[model samples]
Every structure is written in structure tokens, then in C-alpha cells.
Target: MGHADTLLAMGGAFLAAAFFARLGNRIGLPTIPLFTLAGMLLGPHTPGFVLVEDAHDFEMLSALGLVLLLFYLGLEFHLDDLKTGGRRLALAGGSYLLLNVGAGFGFGLALDWGIREALVLAGVLGISSSAIVTKILIDLGRLGRPETRLILGVIVVEDVFLALYLAALQPVIGGAHGVAEVLFQVTKAFAFLLVLAATARYGTRLIGRLIHVRDDELLVISFLGAAVLVAGVSELLGVADAIGAFMVGLILAQTPSAARIRRLVHPLRDAFAAIFFFAFGLAIDPGDFAAVLVPVAVAATLTLLMNVAAGLIVARLYGYGPGPAADIAATLLARGEFALILAAMAATAGLDERLAPFIAGYVLVLAVLGPVAAGRAHLVVRRLTGGRTPDGPDDLAPVEAPERTTSA
Candidate 1:
């Protein structure tokens, strides 16, 4: 496409996303699905008004969206929160992973796909989309709620698990025979995580000094450079780039400039994040959904059940009531970027042909459902629990509805 055409397409995509999101807002729906729906309708895969011939055109911007979303999450997260709830977070995260991943593995095996394909599906079905979760939290204005802290902690644990999971699965999918190669991959991934963790824990002062400046423009440039550079290195070192960006934010969170950085990054994060979801929809071909309908339905149902179970378990551990438990379940129910990543790996490795469509359908289902469920979780909990409200001082009762535009 010519430069003018590219501009027009990009402009049209933004406008369509805004229009759909505005409609969702009027009906009290979440923006994540609406933005995605806009892209799906306009994308080349669907009929009429193709916004872009290739979804790859938005790849870079979408990636930036993911990075910024996680980066802001890390910024909001603090060392003190981890210190106070370390053990609880560990247990909660562990229980969540055990239930979801174990069930997902069994479900994959039940599909009669190959062992390699099952392994891929295990990760795909297990991990929640950090990007979507972050957006929901922000949209619902639930950041101040006590359960939100636990949710973010769980996300951190999942990122760590993902690093090891990918390491173990890579050699299997790549047809590597050497035990040494497997050990090396695991060790390298673990080491990189440790290094970043240690930096977040101990090196804040130096990092703060490096990125600190008098001018907002220069400071923005410095922090953005740091985030993107570390994210690139993390990807090269066999870790997710989002984790790297998150780590950078974590490190900067301890600095004097933390609040300023957050202020500067919010607009960029919102714009890019809208693009991220839109681009995701663009890549999906609606025509393929029929091929994987049954499995997708079953998998999505299983995921909902397991997530709710895990949420109840975590709430019990934290001494929270059904309201918080429902919030936990609904918030973490969506699957996105990670599942797509695994599907791509499966396709590249020539695993089961059905894996891609299955994941695509599954993600699309939950991406819409997850946010809607989260929005109404309190009502669900109230109805189920005989009108007993959330118990904690920081429950969802205090979470005000965010402004309409904030959803994007």
C-alpha cells in the first residue's frame, strides 16, 4: 500500500475501534472485546471494508502495546506489596497454575493430538493474558482493590512459569535430542529471570540515576529506551518481552521519578494497547472458527470452571469472601497473546493442524467473556452467596466505574 493508503487504513482502524468501544460503553460492556470486534469486522479476513490487507502492518505497534501494558503494571506493583504477601502470593499462584495447567494438559491429551501438540496446548490453555487482565483492571478501576494485588502477583508468577515452560517445551518441539541442550535452555531462562529479579530488588538506585532527568521529554525517551532495550534482550534470552518491560517498570517503580514516568506513559500505553487487541483480531480468520467449534467450546468451558475453582481457593487462602473470589475467577479467565504464541510455535513445528484454529477460537471466546464476567462478578457472587457482600475492607464495592474512554 502507498503511504497515503497506509495512513488511511490506520486512521480508519482507530476510528472503527473508537466507535465500537463507545457503543460498548453505552451498553455497559468492556472495551477489550469491542475493540477486537471492530478489527475482526474490518480486517481482510472478513468481508467488507478491509482496514489492512495484512495484519502484520500493525505488528510493531501492537507489540509496543503489550510492552507498555505490562510495564505500567510493574510500575503500579511495589516491593512492599510483595514483601507483605509473599507467602500468600506464592501459594495462590501455585494453586492457580496447578489446577489450570494440569487440567489443560489432560484436556489436550483427551484431544488425541500428539504429545508435542498436547504440551503446546497445555501452555496455551493454562496462562491468562496479562495484557487483557491489565486492561480490565484499569477499566474497572479495580487497582485499589485488595484482590487486584493478588491478581498482579499471580501474573508475575505465571510469567516466571512461562519462562521455564517454554524452555522445557522448545527442545521437544524443535526435535533436539541432547539432554545437555534441555538443561542449558532451562538454566539460561532461569538465570535471566534471577538476574532481572535481583536487579528489581537491589539495583533501583542506580537505574533511577540512569533514567532520571530534569526534562519530561528526555526522561520519557530515556525510560522508553530502557524498557524496549531490556525487552528485546529478554526475548533474545528466551524470555517474554513483556516480562522484560515489566521488570524495567519494576526497577523504575522504586525510583523518585516513578510517578512522573507513569503519568508520561499512560497515553502511549492506551493508544498502543487498542492497536494490540485490534491487530490480534485482524490475524484471526473467522471462517476457521467452525472447524474447531466443539473443542473450543469444551476447552473454554473447562477453563471457566477451573479458573473459578482456583479463584475460590485463592480467596479462601486470603480470607476473602465470594465477591473477591468471583473477581479473581472472572479477571483471570481470558487467554490471548500467550496462546497465540504457542499456536504459532505449534504450526511452525508441524504439530496438529487443528491446534491453531482451536486456540484462535478459544481466545476469541474468552477475550469477550472474561471482561464481561469480571464486570458483573459482584452481582454473580451476591446472587450465589445469598446477598452476602464481599468481606474485606478493600473489596470491589469501592471500585468506581472508570471514565468511558479509559477502557481503551
Candidate 2:
């Protein structure tokens, strides 16, 4: 499609999501599921609607959205919680990642897939839905609760892990000859990230003086330019585009105008992000689900169980009583854009050809369950802990648990 036609199409998609987000909210369903279902309708799997026949452009924009989303995530990444929750964040996220990888690898083994496929499944499952979890906490206005704090910290840790793994996944899955070649690629990625982190700390001034995103049109173009450039750079350097986009986000986060930048980028991001979702619906082969509903249902149930359990346990470790902990657990039970994005990454990395369908099915389930999870969390906490109780002022003490990694 030409630029103008593509722009119009994208605009129409965004409006559709916004329209549906409200409609979903009114009808007691989550906004994300509505958009997702709409996307499925537009996909080639269904007849007569085919808004997205190819997904290359859609993935490109979705990657851009995830990078920015994480950048905003980083803006909130204060390391002060490193004392207590930080350690728990690391431990929990790492343990979960390890467990997920092992389980996924085991599944791969059972399925007789390649090592690459195994790792990809583990990576996809190890990661949870940051977007859904955070929104649940925020919407309930409990983001500051000690239990919520712990859960958020763990979620942040997962994001970091996902980012790192995503960066390495492309090379590892690409058949890079041997360990040394893989190590070299990893080192380059490490070096690249270190440089970007350093730049995020100190480089905004130079970019600001040069880029001058003062005008709305200029701002939007520059925003897209940064995403495209960083993604292209990562591609050139044999790193994942997600890594480059994230680095760009981190750098942008440090800018004085980041909040404003995010505001300006939201409409653009939301538009593409919607197309990205629609593209996923389009990408699903009708047959992937036709004969596999039972397995898909079982997989989704397992995912929900594992993710919620992790959330609750982490909340307890952070000193929350059992009630709030369960709420924290239930609150984070859904997966959306980021998780699916990673699944799509697995497709690009050629890890497991089977991953996309599994993950797509997984996302469809989680999207429908997100708000329900939040509601159940609220109910469980009230029933168990007697409602709206906080972990109290004592948690202001040391954050180290000696057992799990925590974050902020």
C-alpha cells in the first residue's frame, strides 16, 4: 500500500479500537479482547474482510509500540527497591524464567522439536503480560500497595528478562555455528545495550538540540524515524530489532520531554499497535485452532495457573499478607501485546514454527480473561484479607528477602 492509503487504513484501525475499547468497557469485557477479536475478523482467516493480508509492516509497527511501552516502563524503573524487592525481582524473574525455559524445553522434547524451538517456547511462556497487570493495578488505584508493589516489581523484572532474551533469541535461533559465535553476538548486544543505557543517562541534550521535536508533525515523524532507525540498526548489527527499539526508548526516557514525547507518541503508537493486533488475527491459520481447542485450552489454563501463582508468592514475599498477595497474583493473570509480540518474534527467529499459533491462541484466551482476573483478585483479597488492607508502614524497612529478586 502507498503511504497515504496505509495511513488512512491505520487511522481507521485506531478509531476502530478506540471505538471498541469504550464499547467493551461498557459491556463488561476488556478493551484488548475486543480489538483482538476485531483484528481476527479483518484477518485472512475469515472471509471478506482481509484488512491485513501481510504482516511485515504490522510487525514493524508493533515492535515499535513495544519498544516505546518498555521505555515508559523504564521511566518508572527506579532502582531504590533494589534493597528488598530488587533481589526478589531478580530471583523471582530468574527462577520463573529458568522454570519456564525448562518446562518449555521439556514440551519441545516431548513434541520432538529442535533446541531452538524449545528455547523459544520457554521464552514466550516465561514472559507475562506487563500491560494487563499494570493496568489492573492502576485502574484499581492500588499500585502503591505493598502487595501491588511487590507484584509490579516482579513484573518489571520479567520485562528486563524478556528484553535480554529477545535480544539474544535472534542469534541463538539463527544457527550461529557454535558457542563462540553466539558469545560474540551476545557481547555485541551487551556492548550495544551498555552504550545505549549510558546514552539514555547522558545523551538527551544532544538529541534535543538537534531533533527539536517541537512541532506535532515533526514530532510524529521523528518518533517514527527513531523507531525505524533503531530497528534497522539492530538488524544491521545482527541484533533483534526489539532490542534496538527498547534502547531507543530508554534513551528517550531520560529526555526532559519524555512525558510529552509519550503523549505525542500515544496516538501514533496506539494506531500501529492496533494494526499489529489485527495482523496477528490475520496471521492465524484457521486450521491452527480447528482441531486443537482442547490442547489450547489446556495450555491456557496452565499458563494462567503458573503466572497467578508466581504473582501471589512474590506478593507474600514482599511482606503482604495472604489476601493482598492473592489479589496481586490474580491481578496479573492476563497476557496481551508484549507477550504476543515476543511470540511473533519467535516466528521471525524461526525458533518454533508452531509457536505463533500456540501463542496466538494463548493471547486470545488471556485477553478475554484479563479483567476477569482483576475482578477475581479484588474478590479474593476482600474475602481472604477482609478487603482493602495494606501491608502497612513496616515494609518501609529493608527490602532484601534473600530468596527472590525484586524490582521497581
Candidate 3:
């Protein structure tokens, strides 16, 4: 397409996203799914306006969206919060991965798609979309709630797991059989994470000085540069770009300019994030979903059950009631970008033909369902508990526990 046509298509996409999201808001629906639906309706995959002939046209913008989404999430997540729930976060995150990933692997094997296909499915169904979850929390106005901390913490944990998981899976999928090669990949990934963690823990002041500036415009440029640069470096190192951006945000969050950076980045994050989800929808061919409907249904059902069970377990670990448990489950139920990435990897590796469509359908189902479920979490819990809701404040407030003694 010509430059003018590209501009026009982008403009159409943005407007369509805004219109659908507005309509969703009127009906009390979350914007993430609506934005995706907008892309699907207008994309080349479907019979419609065809905003962009290829989703890859928006690939870089979509990547920026993902980076900004995670970056903002990290900015909101203070270092103090991480320190407070370190151990619980590890346990909760580990439990979530074990349940979802283990079940997903077993499900894939049951499909008889092959062991490598099962590995892809494990990651696809196991990891939640951090971008979608971040958007949902903001849109639902639940960012300040106590449960929100756990949700974000769990996502961070998941991202870390993803780094290690991808390293190990890449060799298997690529048909690399050497034990030394696999160990090297794993060690490289682990070392990268360690370096970033150390930086976040101790290099905040240096980073702060580097990015600090009198003008908001300059500061914005500085931080954006840092995020994108680090994301690029991460991708080169076989780590996910989103994690690098997130780590940058986490480190900057400790600086005095954290609030200003957050303020400046909010609008950018929202706009780019819309493009991210829209591009995701644009890539999906709804025609493929028909063949994988049964598998999608089964996978979706399994995901929902596993997520709820994991959420309840985490809630109990943290001494939260059913209400919080419901919230956690519903919020974490969405599988998205990571699933798509895995499907693409599988396709590239000549794995099972059915895997891509299954994942696409599964992500579509949960992306829409997850946000809806989160919105109705309170009502769902109330109904299940016979309409006896938890007492005042406890529903949204952090319960006073020994583990939560540190102040936010």
C-alpha cells in the first residue's frame, strides 16, 4: 500500500477501535475485547472494510503497544510492593503455572498432536496476556484494590517464567538435540534476567539521573528511548521485549520522576495498546476457527477451571475470601499474545497443523470471556455464596495479615 493508503487505514482502525470501545463501555464491557473485535470486523481476514491488507503492517506499532502496556504496569508496581509480597508472589505464581501449564500439556498430548506440539500448547494455554490484564485492571478501575497487587505480581512472575520456558522450548522446537546447547540457552536466559533484576534493585539512581530532565518532553523522549532500546536488546538476547520494557519501568518507578513518567506515558500507552489488540485481531482468520471449535472449547473449559482453582488456592494462601478468589480467577483467565506467538512458532517449526487454529480460537474465547468474568466477579461470588457478600472494606481492602505488614 502507498503511504497515504497506510495512513488512511491506520486512521480508520483507530476510529473503529474508539467507536467499538465506546459502544462496549455503554454496555459495561471491557475495551480490550472490543478493540480486538473492531480489528477483526475491519481486517482482511473477514468480509468487511479491510482496514489493513496485512496485520504485519502494524507489527512495529503493535510491539510498541505491548511494550508500553507492560512498561506502565511496571511503573505502577512499586519496588516496595514487590519486596512486601516476594515470597507469596513466588508461591502464587508457581502454583498458577504448575496447574495451568501441566493441564495444558496433558490436554495437548490427549489431542495426539505430538510432544513438541504439546510443549507449544503448554505455553500458549499457560500464560496470560499481561497487556490485556493490565488494560482490564485500568479500565475496570480496580488498580488500587488489594487484589490488584497480587494480579500484577503474578503477571511479573509469569513473564519471568516465560523467559526460561521459551529458552528451553526453542531448542526442542528447533530440533537441537545437544544437551550442552540446551543448557547454554537456559543459562543465557537466566543470566539475562539476573542482570536485569540486579539493575532494577541497585541501578535506579543511575538510570534516574540519565533520564531526568527539566522538560516533560525531553523526559518522555528519554524514557521511551530507554524502553525501546532495552526491548530491542532483550529480543536480540532471545528474551521477550515486553519484559525488558517492564524492567525499565520497574527501575524508573523507584526514582522521584516516576509519577511524571507515568503521567506522560499514559496517553501513549492507551493509543498504542489499542493498535496492539487490533493488530492481533487482524491476524486471526475466523475461517480456521471452525475446524478447531471442539478443541478450542475443551481447552477453554480446561483453562477456566484451572484458573479458578489456582486463584482460589492463591486467595486461601493469602487469607482472602471467595470474593477475591473470584476476582483473581476471572482476571487471569485471558490468554492472548503469548498464545499467538507460540502458534506462530509451532507453524514455523512444522508442528501440528491444528495447533494454530486451536490456539487462535482459544485466545479469542478467553480474551472476551476473561474481562466479562472479571466485571461480574462480585456478583458471581455473591450468588455462589448465597448472596452473603463479605463485610465492608474487606471486599476491596487488603486484609491485615502478617505477610502484608509493609505499607504501600
Candidate 4:
């Protein structure tokens, strides 16, 4: 095919994905699963329209997409939100982490997984999809709500844990020589982070000054360049590049140029994220999934139950009424991009390919159901709270209309 034809193929794939995604949302289901399914339909395993055989590059591009995702997330975050959300951020986030990780780890051990695999799965379970949750909160215009704010605060906590986990994983997965060497590695890793932190604080300003007078094009390349530089530094330090990318995000997070940077980068993020989902779907062998339906269903069901329980228990402990607690819990039940990323990592690290499809199938089911569960949960809450509004139990009367959108 000619260059234009190849570009057309890429364009057509995304258009189909977007069309199905919107179609899914119109019918009241969240579009997360449909996007993946859309990718699958356009991939090699389908009857026709396979467009992603050149998938090796998508991995890095997808990683870039996630880097932007986290960057945007940090743009809206602060260490201070932990203080503002009351004790709920720490309490609820902490409780949710402990219960979910502990339970997931225990289950992995029971299934005879290695320590590394168990720990990895535990970490994955502990971390929620901040993207999906944040998307829902924004879609609903509930970003300023107490529950929403608390969720973001907890998500920051989760990101901290993710950084630590991803960093510590190298040695835990046997990439180090000894305790002293591991200690040295950890030190080097953190020392590298310090340099990046310094760049965040200092480099951005100089670069901002340099590009201050230019058009937004410079902003686009400069921001992506910073992320790549930090990510390269992380690789040299023998650590996960994600930590470095995340640190870059933290630094650019609250800058005067942050909004401008986000506006410049979001198109690329969305485009590459579509390819990310497509590559993810390519990794799934549906035949493999169908053959082991029983075990897969069991694992998926367990995942759903555990996630919902974790969210609810934390909400209740933080003093939310049962209805709001349940609503928050239900909203958090789906695992999206992060889960796929982790599964890909696990496969590379030699932890059971079967686990990926099982988890993927679960994600597909929950992505469709989670929003309905959350929406209906609001109705249930209104009834229980006796016509109280979601944002404030006494501020406004109950709204019977579809007054919210929770697409992620």
C-alpha cells in the first residue's frame, strides 16, 4: 500500500473505534470495553479489517500515552489535597489498598504463584484506574464533590505506591545481585529521581523562558522531550521508566504552562491510546479465553467482588452514608488501561499468559456493567437518603433525570 493508504488504514481503524465507543455510550454502557472490542474487531483475529500487524511500535507509543495520562492527572493534583480531603484520603485510600492488595496476594499464593507474581498482582489490584475514575467524575461535573475529591486524593496515594512498587520490582524480580547491591540500586534509582526532580523544578523554567515567546509547537515538543529525557535517565539508573515519566508529570503538574501543555498533548495522547488498546486486544487469544471459561469466570467474578468491597468499605469508614458509599464503590469496579499495561508487563516477566486474557475478559464485562451499576446506585442512594442530592444530602432535592455522565 502507498503511504496515504497506510495512513488511511490507521485513520479508518480509529474512526471505527470511536464510532463504536460513542455507540456504546449512547446505549448507557461505558465505552471502555467497547473500545477494546473495537480494537479486537479491527485486529488480526477478526474475520476482516486487520490493521495492526505493525504493533511493536505501539508499545512505546502507548507508554507515551499513559505518560500524558498521568501528567494530566498530576496537573489536577497536589500534595495538599491529601490534607484538604480530611482524614478520608489517607484512611479510605489506605484501607482500600490494604484490603485489595492483601486479598489479591493471598489468592495468588493459593493459586501457587511465585512471590514476585503474587506481589505484582497485589500491586495491580491495589491501584485503581485514576484515568477511568477521573473521566467519570469530570463527565458528571462532579470534580469538586467531596467523594470525587477524596477519590483523587486516594489516587495520588495509589500513584505513590505504584512508583515505589514499579521501582522495587526490578530487584524483587531478581534483577539485583545482593542486599547491598539491591540497596545500591535503590539508592541509584532514587538519586536518579532526585536529578529528575531538580529538572522538574529548574529545567522547566529555563525551557519555559526559552519557548515563552515561541508558538505552542515548541511547547509540544519540549514537554514530550522532557518526558523522554527523564525516562532515558530512569532506564540508565536500572529502574522503570514509568517512575521517571511520572516524576516529569509531577513537575509539570502545576506549572503556569501546564494547561497549555495539556491542550497541546491530548490529541497525541488520545491517538496513541487508541493504538495502545488495539495492541492490547491483539494480545488476547479469544480461543484461549473460551476454552477455560470456568476458571476465568471465577477469577473475574472474584476480582469484581473484591474491588467493590474494597471501595465500599473505605467509603463507609470515611463516614459516607451507605448509599453514597455503595455508589462510589460501584463506580470503581472496572479496570481499564492500567490493568492491560500490567498484564503486558507480567507476560514479559514470565507470569502466566493465561492470566492476561482472564483479566481482560473480566475488564470487558465490568467496563460495560460498572457504569450501569454506578448510575443505578445513585437512584438507590436517593431513595435511601430520602430525596437528598448526591453532592449534598440536604443542598438540593433528588434528581430523577439522567443528570450525569460517567464515561471513562
Write down the TM-score of every candidate: 0.81, 0.83, 0.83, 0.83
Residue lDDT tens for model 3, 218-293: 9999999999998898767756677778778878988889989988998898888889878877876778778889
* Candidate 1 TM-score to native: 0.81
| Candidate 4 lDDT, 1-408, residue by residue in tens | 567766776687678778977897678655556667776676666676677654453566556655665455444554445555566557777777787678767766766657667766676555666667666666566655556645665676676677767777755554567789988887887777677667666676765565443578778788788777777777677876667777776677546776676667667666766666766776666767785576546655666677667767766655556655765676676567666666766766667666777667867776666666766777766777798644434453322111111124
Candidate 4 local accuracy as lDDT?
0.65
Error of 3 at 405 (Å): 20
Model 1 has an lDDT value of: 0.78
Clashes of 4: 0
Which digits, one per residue and each the tens of the lDDT, describe model 1 over residues 27-58?
75556666667777888888887878898788
lDDT of 1 at 97: 94
Q: Global lDDT of each model?
A: 0.78, 0.64, 0.78, 0.65
Error of 4 at 72 (Å): 3.1
**What ranges in model 1 sit over 4 Å off?**
114-117, 129-178, 319-324, 336-353, 371-408
Query: Clash pairs of candidate 1?
Result: none
Q: What's model 2's TM-score?
A: 0.83
lDDT of 4 at 329: 77
Better of 3 and 4 by lDDT: 3
